[model samples]
Target chain A: MKKRDHKECVSALLPVKDTLDLIGGKWKLLIIISIWEGNKHFREIERSIPKLSTKVLAKELKELEMNKLLHRNVIDDFPVRIEYTLTEHAKSLKTVIGTLHSWGLTHRKAIFEK
Target chain B: MKKRDHKECVSALLPVKDTLDLIGGKWKLLIIISIWEGNKHFREIERSIPKLSTKVLAKELKELEMNKLLHRNVIDDFPVRIEYTLTEHAKSLKTVIGTLHSWGLTHRKAIFEK
Candidate 1:
């Protein structure tokens, strides 16, 4: 293999890594899916993912918002409520992530079966 | 809204949560894509993801291997060499992830643009 060829290969992979960095995380995708499934508020998300700590969920939601995958709307109520929904760009990811879920169901073999 | 309806909604989301747990990680998808792009050996993988630390890449590879997303082949020579490839199940995820990459290109809005 040529030395220059190796550098090209690595360079090609940088975008893949960046994409992973955006969507891959312990709670980010769960938050996205939860929002997709109709959880609009922080409490609703917390309710849906029972095992996720509040701090973790908050952090994940912030990251997703930072990544532009979610829209956070703060409703000015007595307690100050926040609602999260998918942005148009994030809405676009629905098909892809949904396909991933389908792949898990139909194609995920027993190797990682819990 | 009824309490039972809320419970049903949460239950419907459990599978999505589980699926997220599988592929959502800083390195997993990148590593999978790297393997798809044709690096098979440990050193080759290391070379492909230049920004990834050796330890982190090794750990991610092992996790993928454990999840049956990657097949690790050991070549017993003077210095035993290991090669990794996607399993059939993992291969099935290609279309989904590729679609995701395309989605990022065509549909990802400017909210998260660099």
Candidate 2:
């Protein structure tokens, strides 16, 4: 309605926007999470998260690799193993995940009480 | 390849899932950030975030209200005024938002360096 400037907040908002754009969906973050928790193989990640289908997991994994969030490894073993691991850049999500974990636990209790 | 248990991490994952489900999009968190910065009126919020269409903003506002993350107030005047504000429950997201902000900043730098 009136002419006002939001430029002051833009510097603060852009990075958060990037963060959301990168990890905004349910599967992307959960996939990184499964790998973070030690599930490397495709099947292990799918099994760890209930309701995540193979198609979605495969897609998210590829996207994460493209984004350089994870490394898709090919081990030439007797059976040939493929594993996924978080890159250094992605390991930086440790704090972000820890913060979400704490808030999520508290939020669950708060929601039920409402 | 191997049979292993991911059961131990379920406690950690569910709340994170809840967190992701609640605030996984670019608009929702940005909307809250705009409100947190004192943009109350619909127009004020609309102008604050770039590339956010009226359709998306309106839809996000309703969803946020449904989730009890914010309150919508209507004031009767010559021109009816509607304002949006975060609730106490949503205020608890302060830590989550802060964490993301820091991580996002770091992430942007890491991305460019690669």
Highest TM-score: which candidate? 2
> DockQ for all models, in order?
0.44, 0.57
Comparing to the true complex, what docking class would candidate 2 get? medium
Alpha-carbon shift of residue A28 in model 1 (angstroms): 1.2
**TM-score, cand. 2 vs. native:** 0.89
The prediction achieving the highest DockQ against the true structure is 2
Candidate 1 structure quality by residue, lDDT tens digits, B4-101 = 22444543355555555667667777778778888888777776665778999878887777777888889899798888888877777767777667
The i-RMS of every model, in angstroms, reads: 2.8, 1.5
Give residue B42's error in model 1 in angstroms.
Answer: 1.1
* lDDT tens digits, residue span A7-47, model 2: 45554577788788778787888888888888999999999
* Cand. 1 TM to true fold: 0.80
Candidate 2 residue lDDT tens string, B78-109: 68889888999789898888888887877865
Best candidate according to lDDT:
2
Model 1: DockQ score: 0.44
In model 1, the runs with Cα more than 4 Å from the true position are: A1-12, A77-79, B1-12, B77-79, B107-109
